[model samples]
Target chain A: MLEKSLKGNLGYWAWVLFLLGIIGVGVICYIVQYNYGLGATGMSRDVTWGIYISQFTFLVGVAAGGLMLVLPYYLHHYKDFARITILGEFMAIASVAMCMLFIMADLGQPMRALNVVLHPTPNSMLFYDMIVLSGYLFLNVVCGWVVLHSEYKGIKYPNWVKPFIYISIPWAVSIHTVTAFLYCGLPGRHFWLTAILAPRFLASAFAAGPCLLMVIALIMKRTTKFDIGRVAQDKLVTIIGYAALLNFFFLGCEIFVAYYSTIPGHMHTLDYLYFGLADHATGQVYNNLVPFMLSSVVMGFAGIGLIFVSRYLKSDPLLALSCLLIFVSFWIDKGLGLVLGGFVPNGLEQITEYVPTFVELGITAGVWATGFFIITVLYKIAISVKLENEKTA
Target chain B: MDSSRRKFLKIAGITAVAGIGAPSALNMLMKQEVQASSAGDGHGAQPAAHGGEGGHGAAPVGKRYGMVIDAVKFHENPGMAEKCIEACHSYYNVPDFGNKKDEIKWLWQVPFTNAFPGDESHYKKDDRTHAMQFMVLCNHCDNPPCVRACPTKATFKNADGMVMMDFHRCIGCRFCMAACPYGARSFNWRDPRGSKDGVPFIKKVNPEFPTRMRGVVEKCSFCDLRVKRGLIPLCVEATGDSKAMVFGDLNDPNSEISQVLKARFTIQRKPSLGTMPSVFYII
Candidate 1:
């Protein structure tokens, strides 16, 4: 099965080499950061977490999004999903791997990370996050590999693997919920204190995760003999449509609560993110994040609207465009806007802006390249095996 | 079932229970033994009834140390805050990174509006409150959010209610910095002992204190080492006035800090958050 990844056409090998080149550049940047400390990045005392942490948060949702395929197929016995379930599991494995790498890149002392395990503090949300993330990664790797192996051999998956599949359904939810707790449970951080944070995370994850899967499936359809039937693709678009709608509804609820309640602490971060907050003393306004945040809202609605329209949904290129829109919308919202918004008008009511250095950008690109590299290899194996199985049958 | 099989099952159950329970039971006993020995040493064994009146040798055990600052006195003395800040930084060997982005300070000052953000009053200005600046530092809160958020227990609350950091154990995750509502913690973004572009970050080295390495979070330990040696914190000593900055055991009613609280109207930063700050300001 592993040998299938080794046997690829010139184009496949070229794509793999391109990703490797990006990864190599990233490693060199990381070595510089390792020697110079986090000072090599643009993060400061005010904005303690920059791109690395934001990427980690967004990828957690993508990893948990794999549940959309696993839950419906396994629990409800939906056979329409049978052909593409392995794709979700493999994607999850890649996403979780990226998440762990992002966390490492964010740490000031990457080597001492094991201290969280050696001296585990049950009280910390991070402690629980470590447990759930690693557990989910383990669950996905075992479940994905074993199921794919059994399918390649043309036999029913082992009965023992069933319990793991069942546990994974809830484990996926735990990973994102714990990530939400890491922010929401903190004191004085008004932006993330809302009770709706976890639900919002899941909703965005459901929308963005499946949207990405659909885009990948469409790509596979064009590039290879793997056609994930029109029915399955349409069903996925439906799931993505409702989830994106819920995500926006939750955002509206947050806005309403912040404005109607009229608490200055609650409203100030929102003001800074959207309308720009004015310093009462100096009269200077900080509004760097306004354009990015507004664009996220605009793209979110436009993407969902396009997908829901019957005419556009019937067109493959239009649907792919819509999926890309929603995916990028959530990426900006969760990956860029959320973390930066929380830190602005920092604890002392002073605004300090963050801009990532070239080194930081290089490292971030490296992590993404690594994620795509893993995805390409895994997907190639799965597609090749499926095509072979179809020919024999 | 057969008698041999039943006997084997009974033995296995006992061994499994012992395997799970013996280490924990031993751990509990070991902790008690340490407590007993420390009590015998008289390090923190004295009763609160003794109080600060008994002088340095008779300092009370199981105490909640606190500080009281007279805002009016600070207003009268313009340069006093700078002096105190200087004393603390030098004592701690805190590095000067030469920029705000990487600056480290154990104590500092902020404008009245920034220090007490909840007070949004427009017309309540009086002589004492006019253009006021407050000295800010780690509150050493009774319910410290940093302690609850530290994944490695690197930042912990001591028996005396002081939030202390073990720099060696800190993974530099900065979660503590985010958890702290007061913005009390600072991370060593670069090596404090190292130089940059042929310029040294630390100009003068304090041989008395250990300079921290890069990639660790540090903050005021309430001068716990000095306090342990029966000396007050460096900042309090720098003020040169007993009432200007008072430090004593809050648990002891007869202590000077307790007396100051009883006699004056005091306020704390963000008291509504319920962190129960040990530092109070007399307005």
Candidate 2:
């Protein structure tokens, strides 16, 4: 028993050391980013936002992914969801921490972030995004704490927790919607200037977020004695598959309308992102390849195919690996394509491109590592408490 | 909870819809102003706003520094505006090259016809093929979108009728740059406080209109510093006796701009976009 505990304890410290190495390097990069400026990053006129914004966009979806489990288990009375609800809440807490970090890394002056609250502009969607993201973070924290506390004490949670859970479901949807609004509502951005952007964002979030959870659940089942259970895991995979299909369908509709109508404003933005519009002279290509188009195609096909692998998704380890790969692919496609594609051949028709410098990359790596660190520490405490409670029971 | 609910319902009903409606209404107000400015061309000689009260008490003191550009003369002088652009850029500490994402500017010329889209399109490109006249600087519009979009209130239309930027307060989101139809705004992607080709740029950083740091928006303020010191806008001075660029007030009938407006048929750029640009073009 002592040796077993030591193995677990050693694993924990090793993970901690790994995290520290990443965070330490990341912090150094962040310092450089602070001392210099956003110009240290690969962002430019045609791509005002680059990797940082994309990371933030992906993390918000990941953060909202928790609602998939929370909603079905709490509101809809899926008893099987009880086993994974705590995991969902913890995943949310981790994802939100990542989301906030990604946003900080993107800002030219991260220190002045408090000014968003100090001088609030109700007209700006950014203000709403701030409120919802923070509120959701708070709600998840409280809900997770209360549920975990009840388990520790071997007692039912106070009735107050129910309302918080209910609030979280809609709040999850709101956080992603407001995030979508950050892009969609901007004027002169033809690609993002869409009515269905919010819904499409929601669909992608539902698909990608839950798919990540399914992979984590599978990992838990394999390495540890903890079992998320086959039924619970299978149901989530199916749900994610359906959501991915919807995301693809809506994306198809957007493409169809843009291409068929042939309105220059709408058509040009899509063409720039997907196929090189007008000329190769006008397009943004790094390493002689259009990064967004290739990544989007690869991810799109893999995601759709993996989701349709019903039996494989339910039982096979390969299916779980496919989900993880597709989830990452979808994230890359969404981040690069959605934000940077909007600004190429900027309003003035100036075609200068952007690439993040070393400082920018360092800051980005630091932000990502910091996110993982938050998740690891949070999860360690949560799992320890759950294990302790299980021993007592 | 009931009271909060009631308040939420009312605000959500009114302000949310109003929030969406406000930009459109603002756009219309701008359109009307542009239309009024265009029609004023038929009226009078000129009354300089600064010419009242002997440059003293209330001196009717404030300058409504508007510009009336002659498009036909632009064909006469190929690069006249470049002098004015150089003068303003020099004073403002705007960098010449580097990160296209964040670069500052005081004035740069845009084609006079493409710059002014609202007028009757009687003049074709081939008719005036030699050279295109340019719209020089900020219009200092009655309803300025830059000020509205600025989160820090860093960009505000001053009491003196200049659309000014407070560099110290700018957080550099560049929404103002994106929102401006004429693409009049610029950002400092890097510290522009350096020397290029052994010529020192940003020698004297003005405190009132402070020199900007990296990643903050800056734009033409109609030479706010010059106007504050009782000088005709640097651009107007550069145009010098060819008197190609006219500067004065629309508010006062005695202003040079007003006199020129009454004498010449002038046009503003993209009046359809409804930015109510104060700068005008005369053919």
Candidate 3:
């Protein structure tokens, strides 16, 4: 397996090198941020969390999305997904790696990470998030490695691996749920105060995770000997299509509750996000996020329309385009809208506009580059074995 | 060696029982020790061990500390806020970044409406009819959301009612900032001790207080250091003794704060959130 991946020509190595180059840039930027503190970013006392936390939250959903395939294939015995279960697991691995990196980037003192473990508090939602996330990451690693290792050798995985696979199903839900609890349990941030946050996280995760998998599967199909089967792709698109609908439904539910109740506490965040609310002292209308959030809603619907048209689903390019749109929409909704929207009209009802600095964006790109690199390497190994197996057959 | 299911079950059972049983046993022993220590040294609510080590002195325990602010005094004097602010920052060695984004404040004044946005009018409404500015700091709540949101107990409610922070222990997650309804906490976006670009805002350091490193959350500890030495909080002492700011044990009915609360109409910030804030403002 290693030999196959290592033997790739100029293009493959260039791809690896390209990822490495971005990672190098990221390291330099991180070093600057580390020296100067969080001041290097645009985050302030008003918006304490920014790109790092938002990305961490979204990636938790992507990491949990592996269970989208795992549960259906394992528990429900939906065997169409069997061929691509390993793909979901591998995607989870990459996403989890990035999730950890994002969390580290968000920390004021990265070296003090172990302090969470040292002085654990059961009352803290963040404590639960750290626990579930690391636990899921471990489960994915062991199960994915063992299953792939056995598959490469043309032997069945040890019977011992089944229990971990079973446990991983519910554990997947826990990761995103706990992450939601991190925001949802806060006293004053009304944007995340709603009960819809966890379920909404799951819905968006289901949509974005599988949409990413479809794109990854398309890449595997074009570049490798693996088919992933049209049946598998269709089944996944079907799951993602309904999930996109559910994501929209949850968003609608949140908006309706805020509007109908007419509670300024709830409605103010929505107003700030959708239409810029007026600032009192300054008398200036602040709608910094309106365009981004409105466009996200529009793009999300457009992606759903593309998914259900029946004609577009048959065209791989169209489906891929739809998935890419969905990925962007959900990322914007959760990663961009959630953190900033949660903070605008902050605890003191003060509006401090937010924008990420170049250093912040560079660190973000570096995290994604790292995730893509991990995914590329792992897929190279898996695709090689699949191609070899096909040739032998 | 005990890999058998029955052996595992037996060990697990004992461990479960001990887990439930150990804490009370320890607490009972500690209560007796605390009583013995209190009798010997007049220190109340002192734990035998904190973070696996003994402490130097009296801990605020069994006493629920509270503060009553006379907003009218600050309203009349105006300059009193300046004195109190100066006293707090100098006493705490709080940093000054000269930029609002990076400013670290323990106690400060905002426009009156910002402090009581809900009561005066919507935060977006500009009306000077009920406008009044006053000093605000950490509420040190009975049900502090910051302490609850902290993954590590870096931010915690002391046995006394004060919300306390252990700076060295914080991982700088900033969940506490989101959790506090009062907007009380501040993150050291950069090192508070010195400036990187050579324009230093921290004019002097308080030798008695430890300055914070960049990437940690900090806020008022209700003058825990001064409190340990039996001194009133710096702000309270500077504000006009018991007239401008009252600090006393809420658990004691005879305490000045308790009597103040009994007589005057005092409002705690965001009491609707049920955080049971120790700090109250009198109009």
Among all candidates shown, the one with the greatest DockQ:
1
Native interface contact recovery, all models: 0.72, 0.23, 0.79
User: Each prediction's DockQ?
Assistant: 0.48, 0.17, 0.47
Recovered native contacts, candidate 1? 0.72
Which has the better lDDT: candidate 1, or candidate 3?
1
Question: Native-vs-model 3 lDDT?
Answer: 0.85
* lDDT score for residue B25 of model 2: 60
Q: Higher lDDT: candidate 2 or 3? A: 3
Give one digit per residue, the lDDT tens place, for model 3 in A184-289. Answer: 9887778888789999999999999999988888876777667888788888888889999999999999989999989888988899989989886888999989
Give the best candidate by lDDT.
1
Which 10-residue window of candidate 2 chain B scores lowest in summed lDDT?
A: B50-59
CA RMSD (A), model 3: 5.8
Q: What is the C-alpha RMSD of each candidate to the true structure, in Å?
A: 5.9, 9.5, 5.8
Positional deviation of A349 in candidate 2, in angstroms? 2.2
Task: List model 1 lDDT by residue over A188-299, tens digit each.
Answer: 8899988899999999999989988989998888889899888888889889999999999999999999999998899998998889999877899889889998998999
